[model samples]
Target: MKTILLPLLIGLMLVGCSSSPSLSNSSSLYQELNGQSGLERLVDAFIQEIAGDEQIFHYFAKSNVDRFREGFITHLCDVSDGPCEYQGDNMIDIHTGMKINEADFNRVVELLINAMEAEGIPYRTQNKLLARLAPLRPEIIHR
Candidate 1:
Protein backbone atom coordinates (compact mmCIF):
# COMPACT_ATOMS: atom_id res chain seq x y z
CA MET A 1 0.00 0.00 0.00
CA LYS A 2 2.84 2.44 0.82
CA THR A 3 4.53 1.71 -2.48
CA ILE A 4 1.28 2.18 -4.43
CA LEU A 5 0.59 5.52 -2.69
CA LEU A 6 4.09 6.84 -3.47
CA PRO A 7 3.73 6.10 -7.18
CA LEU A 8 0.32 7.78 -7.30
CA LEU A 9 1.73 10.87 -5.59
CA ILE A 10 4.60 11.04 -8.08
CA GLY A 11 2.24 10.72 -10.98
CA LEU A 12 0.03 13.49 -9.65
CA MET A 13 3.05 15.72 -9.09
CA LEU A 14 4.21 15.09 -12.61
CA VAL A 15 0.81 15.98 -13.98
CA GLY A 16 0.77 19.19 -11.98
CA CYS A 17 4.20 20.16 -13.23
CA SER A 18 3.19 19.57 -16.83
CA SER A 19 0.15 21.84 -16.40
CA SER A 20 2.17 24.71 -14.92
CA PRO A 21 3.14 27.71 -17.02
CA SER A 22 6.66 28.21 -18.32
CA LEU A 23 8.19 31.09 -16.46
CA SER A 24 11.17 31.68 -18.74
CA ASN A 25 9.49 31.59 -22.12
CA SER A 26 7.38 34.67 -22.79
CA SER A 27 6.45 33.48 -26.24
CA SER A 28 2.79 33.27 -25.33
CA LEU A 29 2.72 36.84 -24.13
CA TYR A 30 4.59 37.93 -27.24
CA GLN A 31 2.05 36.14 -29.38
CA GLU A 32 -0.76 37.83 -27.53
CA LEU A 33 0.90 41.18 -28.30
CA ASN A 34 0.93 40.04 -31.95
CA GLY A 35 4.52 38.86 -32.02
CA GLN A 36 7.48 40.78 -33.49
CA SER A 37 5.33 42.73 -35.91
CA GLY A 38 3.10 43.78 -33.07
CA LEU A 39 6.14 44.98 -31.16
CA GLU A 40 6.99 47.26 -34.06
CA ARG A 41 3.51 48.71 -34.14
CA LEU A 42 3.40 49.25 -30.41
CA VAL A 43 6.80 50.93 -30.40
CA ASP A 44 5.88 53.25 -33.22
CA ALA A 45 2.57 54.14 -31.62
CA PHE A 46 4.11 54.73 -28.22
CA ILE A 47 6.82 57.04 -29.60
CA GLN A 48 4.34 59.03 -31.63
CA GLU A 49 2.02 59.54 -28.69
CA ILE A 50 4.79 60.52 -26.33
CA ALA A 51 6.33 62.89 -28.85
CA GLY A 52 3.03 64.68 -29.31
CA ASP A 53 2.65 65.28 -25.60
CA GLU A 54 4.23 68.67 -25.05
CA GLN A 55 5.11 68.37 -21.38
CA ILE A 56 7.10 65.17 -21.72
CA PHE A 57 8.03 65.62 -25.35
CA HIS A 58 9.86 68.87 -24.58
CA TYR A 59 12.12 67.09 -22.14
CA PHE A 60 12.72 64.38 -24.72
CA ALA A 61 13.33 66.95 -27.43
CA LYS A 62 16.03 68.53 -25.30
CA SER A 63 17.70 65.17 -24.94
CA ASN A 64 18.84 62.75 -27.65
CA VAL A 65 15.44 62.16 -29.24
CA ASP A 66 16.33 59.40 -31.68
CA ARG A 67 18.49 57.49 -29.27
CA PHE A 68 15.99 57.88 -26.48
CA ARG A 69 13.19 56.52 -28.62
CA GLU A 70 15.25 53.62 -29.89
CA GLY A 71 16.54 52.77 -26.44
CA PHE A 72 13.05 52.76 -24.98
CA ILE A 73 11.86 50.28 -27.59
CA THR A 74 14.90 48.11 -27.10
CA HIS A 75 14.41 48.05 -23.36
CA LEU A 76 10.76 47.19 -23.74
CA CYS A 77 11.49 44.42 -26.18
CA ASP A 78 14.23 42.96 -24.03
CA VAL A 79 12.05 42.97 -20.94
CA SER A 80 9.16 41.40 -22.79
CA ASP A 81 11.35 38.45 -23.76
CA GLY A 82 11.48 39.44 -27.39
CA PRO A 83 14.49 38.82 -29.56
CA CYS A 84 16.08 42.23 -29.09
CA GLU A 85 19.04 43.44 -27.12
CA TYR A 86 19.09 46.71 -25.20
CA GLN A 87 22.35 48.51 -25.88
CA GLY A 88 21.74 51.76 -24.10
CA ASP A 89 23.42 53.59 -21.26
CA ASN A 90 22.63 52.63 -17.72
CA MET A 91 19.36 54.16 -16.53
CA ILE A 92 21.04 56.04 -13.68
CA ASP A 93 23.70 57.66 -15.80
CA ILE A 94 21.27 58.44 -18.56
CA HIS A 95 18.87 60.18 -16.19
CA THR A 96 21.60 61.94 -14.20
CA GLY A 97 21.60 65.71 -14.27
CA MET A 98 18.17 65.69 -15.81
CA LYS A 99 16.65 67.14 -12.64
CA ILE A 100 13.54 65.08 -13.20
CA ASN A 101 11.12 65.58 -10.37
CA GLU A 102 8.45 63.12 -9.18
CA ALA A 103 5.71 65.03 -10.95
CA ASP A 104 7.52 64.78 -14.27
CA PHE A 105 8.03 61.08 -13.82
CA ASN A 106 4.37 60.55 -12.99
CA ARG A 107 3.36 62.51 -16.07
CA VAL A 108 5.57 60.36 -18.27
CA VAL A 109 4.07 57.24 -16.72
CA GLU A 110 0.60 58.52 -17.48
CA LEU A 111 1.53 59.08 -21.08
CA LEU A 112 3.02 55.61 -21.25
CA ILE A 113 -0.18 54.10 -19.88
CA ASN A 114 -2.14 55.98 -22.46
CA ALA A 115 0.08 54.71 -25.22
CA MET A 116 -0.29 51.13 -24.00
CA GLU A 117 -4.03 51.53 -23.85
CA ALA A 118 -4.07 52.96 -27.34
CA GLU A 119 -2.28 49.89 -28.55
CA GLY A 120 -4.98 47.73 -26.91
CA ILE A 121 -2.58 45.97 -24.56
CA PRO A 122 -4.65 44.33 -21.85
CA TYR A 123 -4.47 45.42 -18.22
CA ARG A 124 -2.79 42.18 -17.22
CA THR A 125 -0.07 42.67 -19.81
CA GLN A 126 0.37 46.32 -18.91
CA ASN A 127 0.79 45.40 -15.28
CA LYS A 128 3.33 42.75 -16.14
CA LEU A 129 5.30 45.24 -18.24
CA LEU A 130 5.00 47.87 -15.53
CA ALA A 131 6.27 45.44 -12.95
CA ARG A 132 9.40 44.89 -15.01
CA LEU A 133 9.90 48.60 -15.60
CA ALA A 134 9.19 49.68 -12.02
CA PRO A 135 12.62 48.76 -10.74
CA LEU A 136 14.23 51.20 -13.12
CA ARG A 137 12.46 54.11 -11.44
CA PRO A 138 15.09 54.47 -8.76
CA GLU A 139 17.80 54.64 -11.38
CA ILE A 140 15.83 56.92 -13.69
CA ILE A 141 14.47 59.34 -11.15
CA HIS A 142 16.37 62.33 -9.78
CA ARG A 143 15.30 65.17 -7.53
Candidate 2:
Protein backbone atom coordinates (compact mmCIF):
# COMPACT_ATOMS: atom_id res chain seq x y z
CA MET A 1 0.00 0.00 0.00
CA LYS A 2 2.85 2.43 0.90
CA THR A 3 4.66 1.73 -2.42
CA ILE A 4 1.47 2.22 -4.42
CA LEU A 5 0.63 5.54 -2.64
CA LEU A 6 4.18 6.86 -3.15
CA PRO A 7 4.06 6.26 -6.89
CA LEU A 8 0.64 7.88 -7.11
CA LEU A 9 1.84 10.91 -5.22
CA ILE A 10 4.90 11.19 -7.45
CA GLY A 11 2.75 11.07 -10.54
CA LEU A 12 0.42 13.77 -9.17
CA MET A 13 3.37 16.02 -8.34
CA LEU A 14 4.84 15.61 -11.80
CA VAL A 15 1.52 16.43 -13.39
CA GLY A 16 1.12 19.56 -11.28
CA CYS A 17 4.62 20.78 -12.09
CA SER A 18 4.17 20.19 -15.81
CA SER A 19 0.85 22.04 -15.87
CA SER A 20 2.21 25.11 -14.05
CA PRO A 21 2.67 28.30 -16.07
CA SER A 22 6.11 29.35 -17.22
CA LEU A 23 7.15 32.74 -15.84
CA SER A 24 9.83 33.14 -18.49
CA ASN A 25 7.24 33.18 -21.27
CA SER A 26 4.78 35.26 -19.28
CA SER A 27 3.96 38.80 -20.43
CA SER A 28 6.08 41.17 -18.38
CA LEU A 29 6.26 44.90 -17.88
CA TYR A 30 9.41 44.74 -19.96
CA GLN A 31 7.44 43.32 -22.90
CA GLU A 32 4.74 45.93 -22.36
CA LEU A 33 7.41 48.66 -22.66
CA ASN A 34 8.47 46.98 -25.92
CA GLY A 35 11.60 45.28 -24.56
CA GLN A 36 15.24 46.42 -24.65
CA SER A 37 15.01 48.85 -27.58
CA GLY A 38 11.99 50.58 -26.12
CA LEU A 39 13.68 50.77 -22.73
CA GLU A 40 16.74 52.35 -24.33
CA ARG A 41 14.63 54.99 -26.01
CA LEU A 42 12.74 55.71 -22.80
CA VAL A 43 16.00 56.05 -20.87
CA ASP A 44 17.36 58.39 -23.53
CA ALA A 45 14.28 60.57 -23.33
CA PHE A 46 14.41 60.59 -19.54
CA ILE A 47 18.09 61.51 -19.50
CA GLN A 48 17.51 64.33 -21.95
CA GLU A 49 14.72 65.66 -19.82
CA ILE A 50 16.91 65.42 -16.73
CA ALA A 51 19.72 67.31 -18.43
CA GLY A 52 17.41 70.13 -19.29
CA ASP A 53 15.67 70.36 -15.94
CA GLU A 54 17.19 73.06 -13.75
CA GLN A 55 16.29 71.27 -10.54
CA ILE A 56 18.18 68.06 -11.29
CA PHE A 57 20.65 69.00 -14.00
CA HIS A 58 23.21 70.12 -11.46
CA TYR A 59 23.46 66.59 -10.09
CA PHE A 60 24.62 65.36 -13.47
CA ALA A 61 26.84 68.31 -14.36
CA LYS A 62 30.09 66.55 -13.46
CA SER A 63 28.88 63.06 -14.38
CA ASN A 64 29.30 61.12 -17.62
CA VAL A 65 26.00 61.45 -19.44
CA ASP A 66 26.65 58.66 -21.94
CA ARG A 67 27.64 56.12 -19.31
CA PHE A 68 24.78 57.17 -17.11
CA ARG A 69 22.35 56.73 -19.99
CA GLU A 70 23.59 53.22 -20.68
CA GLY A 71 23.44 52.22 -17.03
CA PHE A 72 20.01 53.78 -16.68
CA ILE A 73 18.73 51.74 -19.59
CA THR A 74 20.16 48.56 -18.16
CA HIS A 75 18.81 49.33 -14.71
CA LEU A 76 15.34 50.09 -16.03
CA CYS A 77 15.36 46.93 -18.08
CA ASP A 78 16.14 44.85 -14.99
CA VAL A 79 13.50 46.69 -12.94
CA SER A 80 10.85 46.13 -15.61
CA ASP A 81 11.52 42.36 -15.61
CA GLY A 82 13.42 42.35 -18.88
CA PRO A 83 16.13 39.85 -19.81
CA CYS A 84 19.00 42.34 -19.42
CA GLU A 85 21.21 42.55 -16.35
CA TYR A 86 22.42 45.83 -14.82
CA GLN A 87 26.20 46.23 -14.71
CA GLY A 88 26.23 49.48 -12.77
CA ASP A 89 26.53 50.07 -9.03
CA ASN A 90 23.53 49.31 -6.85
CA MET A 91 21.29 52.19 -5.73
CA ILE A 92 22.75 52.68 -2.26
CA ASP A 93 26.34 52.41 -3.41
CA ILE A 94 25.84 54.75 -6.36
CA HIS A 95 23.86 57.42 -4.52
CA THR A 96 25.61 57.22 -1.16
CA GLY A 97 27.87 60.20 -1.68
CA MET A 98 25.48 62.18 -3.87
CA LYS A 99 23.48 63.55 -0.92
CA ILE A 100 20.25 63.39 -2.88
CA ASN A 101 17.36 64.81 -0.88
CA GLU A 102 13.64 64.01 -0.94
CA ALA A 103 12.80 66.99 -3.13
CA ASP A 104 15.49 66.09 -5.64
CA PHE A 105 14.36 62.48 -5.77
CA ASN A 106 10.75 63.55 -6.20
CA ARG A 107 11.77 65.89 -9.01
CA VAL A 108 13.56 63.06 -10.75
CA VAL A 109 10.51 60.82 -10.43
CA GLU A 110 8.33 63.56 -11.90
CA LEU A 111 10.71 63.99 -14.81
CA LEU A 112 10.72 60.25 -15.43
CA ILE A 113 6.92 60.14 -15.45
CA ASN A 114 6.85 62.97 -17.94
CA ALA A 115 9.42 61.25 -20.10
CA MET A 116 7.39 58.03 -20.16
CA GLU A 117 4.32 60.01 -21.14
CA ALA A 118 6.23 61.72 -23.93
CA GLU A 119 7.30 58.30 -25.20
CA GLY A 120 3.60 57.27 -25.43
CA ILE A 121 3.75 54.59 -22.69
CA PRO A 122 0.33 54.18 -21.13
CA TYR A 123 -0.42 55.58 -17.65
CA ARG A 124 -1.03 52.17 -16.05
CA THR A 125 2.24 50.82 -17.37
CA GLN A 126 4.07 53.90 -16.15
CA ASN A 127 2.60 53.37 -12.70
CA LYS A 128 3.62 49.72 -12.72
CA LEU A 129 7.23 50.64 -13.46
CA LEU A 130 7.16 53.43 -10.93
CA ALA A 131 5.82 51.08 -8.27
CA ARG A 132 8.73 48.74 -8.88
CA LEU A 133 11.16 51.65 -8.52
CA ALA A 134 9.51 53.27 -5.52
CA PRO A 135 11.27 50.96 -3.09
CA LEU A 136 14.62 52.49 -3.97
CA ARG A 137 13.74 55.79 -2.33
CA PRO A 138 15.42 54.84 0.92
CA GLU A 139 18.65 54.03 -0.84
CA ILE A 140 18.49 57.07 -3.10
CA ILE A 141 17.18 59.91 -0.97
CA HIS A 142 18.85 61.77 1.92
CA ARG A 143 22.07 60.10 1.04
Candidate 3:
Protein backbone atom coordinates (compact mmCIF):
# COMPACT_ATOMS: atom_id res chain seq x y z
CA MET A 1 0.00 0.00 0.00
CA LYS A 2 2.74 2.48 0.91
CA THR A 3 4.66 1.80 -2.28
CA ILE A 4 1.58 2.27 -4.48
CA LEU A 5 0.61 5.51 -2.69
CA LEU A 6 4.12 6.91 -3.03
CA PRO A 7 4.19 6.28 -6.79
CA LEU A 8 0.73 7.76 -7.23
CA LEU A 9 1.74 10.92 -5.38
CA ILE A 10 4.89 11.24 -7.45
CA GLY A 11 2.93 10.85 -10.67
CA LEU A 12 0.44 13.51 -9.57
CA MET A 13 3.23 15.91 -8.72
CA LEU A 14 4.84 15.36 -12.13
CA VAL A 15 1.55 16.03 -13.90
CA GLY A 16 0.97 19.20 -11.95
CA CYS A 17 4.46 20.48 -12.63
CA SER A 18 4.18 19.70 -16.32
CA SER A 19 0.91 21.64 -16.71
CA SER A 20 2.10 24.77 -14.92
CA PRO A 21 3.32 27.74 -16.93
CA SER A 22 6.94 28.79 -16.63
CA LEU A 23 7.46 32.04 -14.75
CA SER A 24 9.28 33.67 -17.67
CA ASN A 25 6.65 32.63 -20.23
CA SER A 26 3.87 33.66 -17.89
CA SER A 27 5.50 37.05 -17.57
CA SER A 28 5.84 37.31 -21.34
CA LEU A 29 2.22 36.30 -21.93
CA TYR A 30 1.24 38.96 -19.41
CA GLN A 31 3.27 41.53 -21.30
CA GLU A 32 1.35 40.60 -24.45
CA LEU A 33 -1.56 42.54 -23.01
CA ASN A 34 0.36 45.40 -24.61
CA GLY A 35 1.78 46.67 -21.38
CA GLN A 36 0.02 50.04 -20.91
CA SER A 37 -1.67 49.95 -24.31
CA GLY A 38 -3.48 46.67 -23.81
CA LEU A 39 -4.29 47.65 -20.26
CA GLU A 40 -5.87 50.88 -21.52
CA ARG A 41 -8.22 49.01 -23.85
CA LEU A 42 -9.16 46.53 -21.17
CA VAL A 43 -9.95 49.35 -18.78
CA ASP A 44 -12.11 51.07 -21.36
CA ALA A 45 -14.21 47.97 -21.92
CA PHE A 46 -14.64 47.40 -18.19
CA ILE A 47 -15.58 51.02 -17.54
CA GLN A 48 -18.06 51.08 -20.39
CA GLU A 49 -19.72 48.00 -19.05
CA ILE A 50 -19.92 49.52 -15.58
CA ALA A 51 -21.17 52.86 -16.82
CA GLY A 52 -23.94 51.23 -18.81
CA ASP A 53 -25.35 49.59 -15.73
CA GLU A 54 -28.18 51.67 -14.35
CA GLN A 55 -27.86 50.04 -10.95
CA ILE A 56 -24.25 51.20 -10.49
CA PHE A 57 -23.58 54.22 -12.65
CA HIS A 58 -24.86 56.61 -9.99
CA TYR A 59 -22.16 55.49 -7.60
CA PHE A 60 -19.48 56.63 -10.01
CA ALA A 61 -21.15 59.83 -11.18
CA LYS A 62 -18.73 62.10 -9.37
CA SER A 63 -15.77 59.76 -9.48
CA ASN A 64 -12.74 60.25 -11.71
CA VAL A 65 -13.52 57.65 -14.31
CA ASP A 66 -10.19 57.85 -16.14
CA ARG A 67 -8.12 57.58 -12.99
CA PHE A 68 -10.16 54.75 -11.58
CA ARG A 69 -9.98 52.95 -14.92
CA GLU A 70 -6.22 53.28 -15.18
CA GLY A 71 -5.70 52.20 -11.59
CA PHE A 72 -7.76 49.09 -12.20
CA ILE A 73 -5.77 48.27 -15.31
CA THR A 74 -2.50 48.68 -13.44
CA HIS A 75 -3.70 46.47 -10.66
CA LEU A 76 -4.85 43.78 -13.07
CA CYS A 77 -1.62 43.89 -15.03
CA ASP A 78 0.55 43.75 -11.95
CA VAL A 79 -1.38 40.86 -10.48
CA SER A 80 -1.28 38.93 -13.79
CA ASP A 81 2.54 38.66 -13.73
CA GLY A 82 2.90 41.71 -15.94
CA PRO A 83 5.74 44.20 -15.60
CA CYS A 84 3.89 47.06 -13.98
CA GLU A 85 3.45 48.46 -10.50
CA TYR A 86 0.20 49.63 -8.96
CA GLN A 87 0.61 52.82 -6.93
CA GLY A 88 -2.84 53.72 -5.80
CA ASP A 89 -4.81 53.55 -2.57
CA ASN A 90 -5.39 50.15 -1.07
CA MET A 91 -8.70 48.41 -1.84
CA ILE A 92 -10.25 49.17 1.55
CA ASP A 93 -9.30 52.83 1.67
CA ILE A 94 -10.34 53.45 -1.91
CA HIS A 95 -13.91 52.37 -1.33
CA THR A 96 -14.36 53.82 2.17
CA GLY A 97 -17.05 56.42 1.56
CA MET A 98 -18.39 54.81 -1.59
CA LYS A 99 -20.46 52.44 0.52
CA ILE A 100 -20.02 49.53 -1.85
CA ASN A 101 -21.90 46.46 -0.81
CA GLU A 102 -21.42 42.80 -1.81
CA ALA A 103 -24.04 43.10 -4.51
CA ASP A 104 -22.30 46.09 -5.97
CA PHE A 105 -18.95 44.35 -5.92
CA ASN A 106 -20.43 41.31 -7.56
CA ARG A 107 -22.01 43.42 -10.24
CA VAL A 108 -18.68 45.05 -10.95
CA VAL A 109 -17.02 41.66 -11.12
CA GLU A 110 -19.61 40.46 -13.58
CA LEU A 111 -19.05 43.49 -15.72
CA LEU A 112 -15.34 42.79 -15.62
CA ILE A 113 -15.97 39.23 -16.68
CA ASN A 114 -18.02 40.42 -19.61
CA ALA A 115 -15.33 42.86 -20.56
CA MET A 116 -12.74 40.13 -20.49
CA GLU A 117 -14.92 37.94 -22.65
CA ALA A 118 -15.47 40.72 -25.15
CA GLU A 119 -11.71 41.08 -25.46
CA GLY A 120 -11.37 37.38 -26.32
CA ILE A 121 -9.30 36.59 -23.24
CA PRO A 122 -9.41 32.85 -22.59
CA TYR A 123 -11.14 31.40 -19.52
CA ARG A 124 -7.84 30.32 -17.99
CA THR A 125 -6.49 33.84 -18.17
CA GLN A 126 -9.74 35.25 -16.84
CA ASN A 127 -9.74 32.81 -13.94
CA LYS A 128 -6.12 33.60 -13.19
CA LEU A 129 -6.91 37.31 -12.99
CA LEU A 130 -10.05 36.70 -10.95
CA ALA A 131 -8.19 34.55 -8.46
CA ARG A 132 -5.74 37.33 -7.82
CA LEU A 133 -8.50 39.89 -7.33
CA ALA A 134 -10.78 37.67 -5.23
CA PRO A 135 -8.90 38.38 -2.00
CA LEU A 136 -9.84 42.06 -2.27
CA ARG A 137 -13.52 41.23 -1.78
CA PRO A 138 -13.44 41.69 1.97
CA GLU A 139 -11.70 45.03 1.65
CA ILE A 140 -13.83 46.41 -1.20
CA ILE A 141 -17.23 45.38 0.05
CA HIS A 142 -18.36 47.79 2.76
CA ARG A 143 -21.51 45.91 3.62
- Whole-model Cα lDDT of every candidate shown, in order: 0.77, 0.90, 0.81
Q: lDDT per residue, candidate 3, 1-143, as tens digits?
A: 99999999999999999889985455654665556777778789989997899978998899898788778888887777787788898887888888888888899899989988888777876777788789989988873
Span of ten consecutive residues with least summed lDDT in model 2? 18-27
**Which predicted model would earn the best TM-score?**
2
**Which ranking of candidates, highest lDDT first?**
2, 3, 1
Q: What digit string (tens of lDDT, one per residue) describes model 2 on residues 1-143?
A: 99999999999999998889865456799988989889888988898899899999998999998899888988988898789899888899999888998899999999999899989998878999999999989999877
Provide the global lDDT of candidate 2 against the true structure. 0.90
Pairs clashing within candidate 3: none
Worst 10 residues of 3 by lDDT: 23-32
Q: After superposition, how far is residue 114 of candidate 3 from its true place, in Å?
A: 0.6
